[model samples]
Target chain A: MDTVCSINNLARCLVEGGFSPDLANLLTLLGGVVLVATIPLVTVIFLIWIERKVAARVQDRLGPNRVGPVGLLQTVADALKMLTKEDITPTGADKFIYNLAPVIAFATVILMWAVVPFTPLHIGADVGIGVLYFMAVASIGTVKIMVAGWSSNNKYALLGAFRTIAQLLSYEVPLVLSLLIPVMLAGTMSLQGITEAQGGMWYLFIAPVAAFLFYVANLAETGRAPFDLLEAESEIIAGYNIEYSGFKWGMFMASEFLHAFTAALFFAIIFMGGWWGPFVQEVPLLGALYLVGKTAIVYVFGLVLRATVPRVRIDQLMALNWKFLVPLAIANVLVIAFLIQVLKALGLMPVPGADIIAHLPMTVVMLLGNLVIIAVAMQVLRNQGREEKMAQEARMAARQQRVVKEVRTPAGAPVGD
Target chain B: MLEFNASTVAFVVMTLFILGGALGVVTTRNLIHATLYLILSLFGVAGYFVLLSAPFLAAVQVLVYIGAIAILIVFAVMLTRSMTRMSEILNGQWLLSAIVGAGLFLLLVIGVILPTWGNGGLLDATVSAPSQVVIDTVDLGKALVDRNGFVLPFEVASLLLTAAMIGAIVIARDDTE
Candidate 1:
């Protein structure tokens, strides 16, 4: 389902609707943004409701059931609670950043919402550099988290902020590199352009390994389990958001939900053919509806992952990324490039033959090669963990030997010792 | 000169943002304030870029400048010892610089407006001529991956990134090592 909605599909849909493709594209972009913001906001509210209901089911208890037929109004009631809660400011905190953090976090993710070209026509600003736009803006969320953490002036908050920053910085690299494959395959940075190129076949079919890596990297980015070591409540005590309360916290929560949606949206754009519903592609209204429905379903996949998975350990997490993802990403880039060249030469791929690369089949072969890289990376990281453990044991032994030497005469010197 | 439209109004405001930010950068005594203002200024510049239909450039400006460089400057400032000073933002060099800045601003404004007085005809004729080189993103992208695609300069950009990475490692690592 996560296939590219080619430009032909987009144009066909637009023309059928009696609109110019370019003009439809502009309108689509504007609508896509509004959809991006509104859909996520609505999704977040819905998710919050679903989360409580799920928690109730897990605990074997009935959840909020009084207001508006089986407690559907429960989430609304929660919002009202937040609205009435008194705003608080710590005596010794940076007022500027403290206030700005939530706003920035809430806002930066929306910029990301715009770059994704939905149904090819109802897109955001389909600039030539859409992917770059996504990459550039996504990281700004770090500053927001950092500011939120720093302004809190609490130790736990500080460490949480640091961890969040570190997590984002590390995962962002692999995420970018993995996504680069689709770009390399499509040979364009624009979201719409890439989708259009893939009209022949979804990059996922050819670049399965890249797609897998992208999903994992993105899951980590969205702070889902197996990667969400930053905000482990048992470890960091609410991470960088410990100090936030009331509406400020609501904004942060809203941003997180939005992030989750956008992450899913990007993944859907890459993997699921965005707006490629059955008769929806050629039909006008049905296509738009299908696109939104598909996107939301993609979003739900992440939410389910969050509900199901458990967070991984921090050191283990960092090691998995540094020793595994980075190498795989670098290798992936090289293999794709070489494969593209070979495919061009062999007159197989439709790529300009004069470049004289190999064929499309060769490109597919190179992409398949990633599974081997993933297996190797997994093995390498497992070995790396063993080495780190051995090193740690050696240090502990040396410290124990020092204590033994220093304590030789202490037996008779002091009972307390 | 030419009167403004909605976009032109936006452009003027954006220009002010960059100018004010630039002014803040040079004039402000508090480096942190300067950094904040710099973020503001770059943000304005980005708005200007968007207005000019170069969304990519604007996005890059925000990403590289506001996200990376400005944050780095703030981080560096925090590491320095003089961060605690709470005083008036301006100091000794500000007064002199302000006078010079004002004069330069006046001169530029005059230079721009002066062209409208009959002499603007020369500028209009020059502007009306058809541009030989088409400037667009696709053209730029073609220039990028074009085998002969300005590869030399692109390589230089990569080289700069490498140097910066090395510099970051040196500056950020604990010196005790």
Candidate 2:
């Protein structure tokens, strides 16, 4: 009974008033991309300010109050200073990598924004393998770090480059493993799908240890304390960045902080249940805001920790990775895998131990296993302290006997007989 | 008159890059500079993969070529620092050899660029087909495992890489005994 509507009518429905559907999609995509890229830069500046204040307050200082009305514009002033400064390259340096290294390091982080989904409508590239794509891009920055260090041809730079490699290798496994826990629960890699999976229950409740591991591993990955051996300021004198000056040095500092923020953002996305709060779906676009807010909270937490803690030694860092975190990660992965398998074996479809209680043992095993490990490690520490005390007393007794004999006999000190 | 589109633009750009890189590699005195130019050239080709609507391949190009191969080249240059510090020009009758090489290179460039001059019928035929097709990574992995497009080659390549890796490790061993 209805006549056929015109093609323009259908097109108008799709266009929603502005441009043709195809062109409109492209425009919206470009706009979303601009917003995504701009968000990190803006967040980095604001975070630096927050960090400055948080750091000052933690150490009982007044903080940055010189720039604008309680130092609100301090980062802006810093940015302007960096922008106006001279870019220097050493004479013997490889000019190409020397110039390109900072840009590549910065751009690697920015390009990763393409894979991060902001909202349902506002996504960068909705590729099939977005999560892996992000990991790949993030890892490329390590290459840039190495190149910058080696190309500088300074011994400090070479040492820093080697430390950078070791750090990346150590932390990458645990970080990726902690991330896999959430992905296992969510059952998908798509950011949208992962968020949707968190609607009923966030993975944080089921796996708090994974969240802790993620934070620690991310700090290490970004070369921040207590894992900043590559940038061990006292020992190596600014590490890989010793040869860099002015804007180039500024770029490394900026990249370091920005990468930390980006990892914090990812940690918030996966573990903290991005942008979802109690009854937040009532507001249409509040999810994106909530996500940003949660991520910023995590970023602030990282900055606070960085300011509060002193950097750990390189040996301690390597020991923590190889001895502790790696074992924990392996256990977590096996637990997750076994739980999924047991759940599938039983009639229970999604929830592993919903009805039968068969998978309860596995879940209990994971949590209790980690707890037991922590207890045993503490006991081992106490025992080692006791042993060291005894050893110290024995050494002191031997030294005293030698001194007494020498005092009595004057020259030969043969008082043992 | 040459009609230009995205594909044409990308092809011209990549061709320029490949030729320029080969020239630089051959002519540059500094080994490190040659490696840098090689990376620049690879990146230009990767950009063409993007223009061809194969962003995945473009990404792989940069990751494998610049990230891996170019890095290896630069590392070798650093490791052999003593050997790379010679004069820019080679001693003993280098200019004569260079001139002859340049003449031959010019002939090849002219032969390709001005195809109307003597490329026969190759210039007239429009290349309607894409030069390369992008297979998705998951699909590529499946194909490599499932014996359709890539299984044999994949196994062969993996074996080759394993052999090379082992050889290098063995050769670099400390030989304490």
Candidate 3:
């Protein structure tokens, strides 16, 4: 056990202790996986509690103070309650798929943890295609929603699934486009590489528009407000998981909370420089603390937004994605790519592995490029808003004229006819 | 006889996924179930790409095929009435369709196996082992845009996709508006 400091050490120790090499390697790999997987499972309990407290605070209420000191054990109690509750299966529901959906929903989120770089030294797998792997796993989450909705054998569930698919599939375009920025800047799709590359300066400074786009798209991706049309309680009940109950429903809820946190974690890693802070290189464990701190900030922001913002209508949601985010993301990518090339040609770009000071010139140029795009986009939005307001006023005026005419002609008379 | 190695075990598992999923797709009475099965099959192919050491390709396969294509198919199935379940598995042209399917399968088998057989049967191809060949994703990205590489074909493919997207929008647009 003393040799279990790292997976490699553990495997080596086992091999030296007379265990077969293959068996030792397999055991260590399994142990590493279980260790990584448990972090989310354990953290999600605290996250749910934190979310409730934040929401309660924003809405002027105390949240679960009775469960334990500061309501620390509230999520545990809720989990117990959920477990003891009766599980119901609707008549005519596809039982296999209904059972499978929650599992997939929970598993998909956990699978994403495989690629998350917690520290410079700690990662689950550090796969070469980490970013794309995250995208792929996130996409599978849609299928889980679809399965849940379809298997529930309810109209509301089906409608919720449809909305979920539309919202998820639409938001994914901008999400992927925004993700490319970090990949391009780092010249690697692996999350660890991206984090390392951001050591000089976080991509948030270099490509603020892309960061903004990623944040917005991530909010939509996680089905959080104001883009949370999928489960709009007033309209679709509980959405895809409407038919689920007991621990099954708990699984869906747990996954949703965890997914939101994971998105924040990825956002922090991609844009805020994951595991990179003063003295972090000397102490790898401190890097984990930095990652957690960054994730917490982003997560709290998401919770506050969710608490404050009203959910957008389905049409507005679609319009925002296709009309605004998608186009803006595309333009941002193109501009950034062009700027990188120009900087390189002019010898202004920082050499690979340069320090923060060396990155200043290139970062400044890219930041200005992003600011210009943002300014232009704001102007376009302002013009569009004014035009829409004028159209509304004209329509109101015409309606007023018609009403006045009707009153002058006497009500119910055939004067217009 | 196949070697009892990790790769062999993984390959066997992937083969099961692909074949089982394919069988389930055709045999299922429900359209939604069939689509799900198709996704499973596609996912197995992605697994094969991973096994072949092309993690980038594997990820793209899952993203594009299982994520986008299968979801679109599911949406389409849900949109059409009475498409989820069918009472009859066979249509009037089942016999003709079966013959076509069989022919296509045979052609695929011959095309895949013939070239490999000339060397040392299907199992002993000249392709290097996955562990022996390491291709960095950065190299893959460069090759896509490199002047002497896939730049022309890549641009052309993207252009074709753009054209197709515009055509779709045009067809779906409300002419009265």
Q: Scoring each candidate complex against the real one, what DockQ results?
A: 0.51, 0.19, 0.84
| Tens-place lDDT digits, model 3, residues B14-85 | 899999999998788888898889988999999899888888899989999989999989877866788787
Off by over 4 Å in 2: A1-29, A151-153, A279-282, A349-417, B1-170
- What DockQ class does candidate 1 belong to? medium
For the candidates in turn, chain A alone yields TM-scores of: 0.78, 0.83, 0.97
Give lDDT per model, in order: 0.73, 0.73, 0.91
Which residue pairs collide, candidate 3? none
Q: Each prediction's TM-score against the native?
A: 0.78, 0.73, 0.96
Task: Compare the candidates by lDDT and give the number of the best one.
Answer: 3
Name the regions of candidate 3 deviating beyond 4 angstroms.
A1-8, A411-417, B118-124, B127-134, B170-177
Q: Going through the candidates in order, what is the number of backbone clashes in each?
A: 25, 1, 0
lDDT of 3 at A413: 71
Give the per-residue Cα lDDT of candidate 3 at B61: 92
Give stretches of model 1 more than 4 Å off.
A1-36, A53-71, A153-155, A288-298, A308-317, A350-363, A385-417, B23-33, B81-85, B88-134, B145-149, B174-177
Point out the higher-scoring one by DockQ: 2 or 3.
Answer: 3
Residue-wise lDDT of candidate 2 within A1-417, one digit each (tens)? 344434324444446664777666555656667877887778777767887898898889989999998998998999889888887777788787788888888888888777665654446677654555566576667777777886797888878877776787678778777877777776666666676666655566557678878889889988877788888878887778788887788778778888888888777777766766755667636777877888888888887788778888888889889878888787777766676676567644335213225434444544564465557656866896799899999999999999999777866655556
Highest-DockQ candidate: 3
